[model samples]
Target: MRALIAAAIGLAAALAVVLTVTAIGAPPGETSPKPLRTTVPEHP
Candidate 1:
C-alpha cells in the first residue's frame, strides 16, 4: 500500500516536471530562433 502511494507520487512529480519544461521551453521549429538541441557551445 505504501509502495503504491509512493509510485503515484513519483509519477505525479515526473509529469509535473515534463509539463513545466514543455511550457517554459519553446518547441523546435522554423519559427523558433534556436533549436532545442544545439551542437555549438555557448561562448559567454
Candidate 2:
C-alpha cells in the first residue's frame, strides 16, 4: 500500500515537471509576422 502511494506521488510530480518545462519552452505570440503580398506587372 505504501509503495502504491509513493508511485502515484512520483507520477504526479513527473507530470507537473513536464508540463512546466513545456510551457516555458514554448515561443511567445507575435514573435514572427506574416509577409505582405505585392502585385506584379505583366510584360507585353
Q: Whose TM-score is greatest here?
A: 1
lDDT of each: 0.90, 0.88
lDDT of 1 by residue, 1-44 (tens): 99999999999999999999998998676676766875777898
Return the number of clashes found in candidate 2: 0
RMSD, model 1, all Cα superposed?
A: 7.4
lDDT of 2 at 39: 72
Q: How many backbone clashes does candidate 1 have?
A: 0
Write one digit per residue (lDDT tens) for candidate 2, span 1-44. Answer: 99999999999999999999998897766654876658776879
- Please give the range of 10 consecutive residues that has the lowest summed lDDT in model 1: 29-38
Pairs in clash, predicted candidate 2: none
Give candidate 1's error at residue 12 in angstroms: 0.1
Candidate 2 runs further than 4 Å off:
26-44
